[model samples]
Target: MATPTPPVVPHQGRRRASGALEGEVLAALQRAGAPLTPREVQATLSGELTYSTVVTILSRLHGKEVLTRTPRGRAYAYAPLTDEAGLAARRMHKVLDGRADREVVLTRFADGLNDEDAALLRRLLTGAVPGPW
Candidate 1:
C-alpha cells in the first residue's frame, strides 16, 4: 500500500518583522498628533493586536523615553516625544554611542550613502539650510 501524505496546514496569521508592531504603533500615535489612550491606539491599529498588547507596547516605549505618558482616568495616555526622523536619528546615535571607533563607523555610513544623500549631508554639515528634497 502507498504511504498516506500528511495534511498541509496554512499559517493562521502572517508573521511580522521584529519591531514592526512598535513601528506601527508609533506611526499611529504620530498621525494622531496628540496623546492617545490604549483603547484608542488599539482601535487605530489593524485590530490584530490586543488592548493589553497595546498597553505593553506603550509602556515599553515610555520606558525607552521614546514616548511620554500622562494619567487619564484609570489608564494612561501616550504620545511620542519625537517624530519619525527624530526616532531614526536616535537609533543612529544609539548605534554609535559605545563604539570606540565612531569615526570609522561614520565613515562607513557616509561612504554607503548615495550621491544625492552625500551631497545633502555635505550641505547640512557646511551649515547650508537647503529646502527639503
Candidate 2:
C-alpha cells in the first residue's frame, strides 16, 4: 500500500501585530472620518478582531481620552478626539480637573519644564509671538 500524504493547511487567519492593534483601530477611525459603531470598526479591520474585542478597546481608549465615545442607541459610537496634540491637551485637562489643588499641580508641571519650554510658555501667556517651530 502507498503511504498516505498528510494534507497541508495554510495559516488560517490574520495575526495581530505585537502592539499595532491600537494603531490599526485608531487609523481605521481616522479613515472613517466619522463616529463608528464597534461592529463597523471591526469590519474595517476585516473581522480580524471580535466585536467584543473592538468594543473593549474602544472603551479603554475613551477612558484614556484617546478616543471619544457618544451615545448610540444600545451602544456607544467612537471617534478620535483629534490628533496627538489634542489628546495631550485633553489629558492635561483631565489631570487638572481631577486635582483639588490646581496650584500645586501647575507648580509641579512648570518645575518639570526646561528653560526653553518655560520661556515658550511665558511667551504664550503674554500673547507674544512664539519661537518658530
Candidate 3:
C-alpha cells in the first residue's frame, strides 16, 4: 500500500477581519507621512506581509480612491489622501449616498447617537466651533 502524506497544518493565529490587511497597510502609509514603494511598505510592515501581498493591498486601496500613487523609479509609490478620521467620514458619506431615503437615514443616525455625540453634532450643525475631539 502507498504511504499517506502527513496532514497539512494551518497556521496558528487569531483570524484577521476582512479589510484588516488594507487597514494595516493604510496605517503604515499614514505613519510614513510620505509616499512609499511596495518594498518600502513591506519593510514598514516589518516583513510580516509578503511583498506581493503589500503590492496587492496598495493596488486595492488605490483603486478604492483611498490612496494616490505616483511613478517612482521602477515602481509606484502610494500615499493616503487623508487621515483615519477623513476615511471614516468618507465611509459614512458613502453609506448615506447609497440610500434613497437620506433624511430618514440621517434621522435614524442622529437618533442613535449618544448625548455627547448628539451635542457635538448639534454644535457642528449650528456652525459652532467646537473644541478638539
Best by lDDT: 3
Q: Against the hidden true structure, what lDDT does model 1 obtain? A: 0.90
lDDT score at residue 102, model 3, on the 0-100 scale: 100
Any idea what lDDT model 2 has?
0.86
lDDT of each residue in 1-133, candidate 1, tens digit only: 9999999998778877638988889999999999999999999887878998888888888888899999999999999998888888898899999799999999999999999999999998887966543
Segments in model 2 whose C-alpha atoms lie over 4 Å from true places: 1-24, 46-48, 60-77, 130-133
RMSD list, candidates in order:
3.2, 6.7, 2.9
Where is model 1 more than 4 Å wrong at Cα? 1-11, 130-133
State the lDDT of candidate 2 residue by residue for 2-27, as single tens digits. Answer: 99999998976887763487778988
* Model 3: per-residue Cα lDDT over 35-110, one tens digit each: 9999999998889888988899999999899999999999999999999999998999999999999999999999
Better of 2 and 3 by TM-score: 3
TM-scores of all candidate predictions against the true structure:
0.83, 0.60, 0.88
Candidate 1, number of clashes: 0
Of the candidates numbered 2 and 3, which has the greater lDDT value? 3
TM-score of 3: 0.88
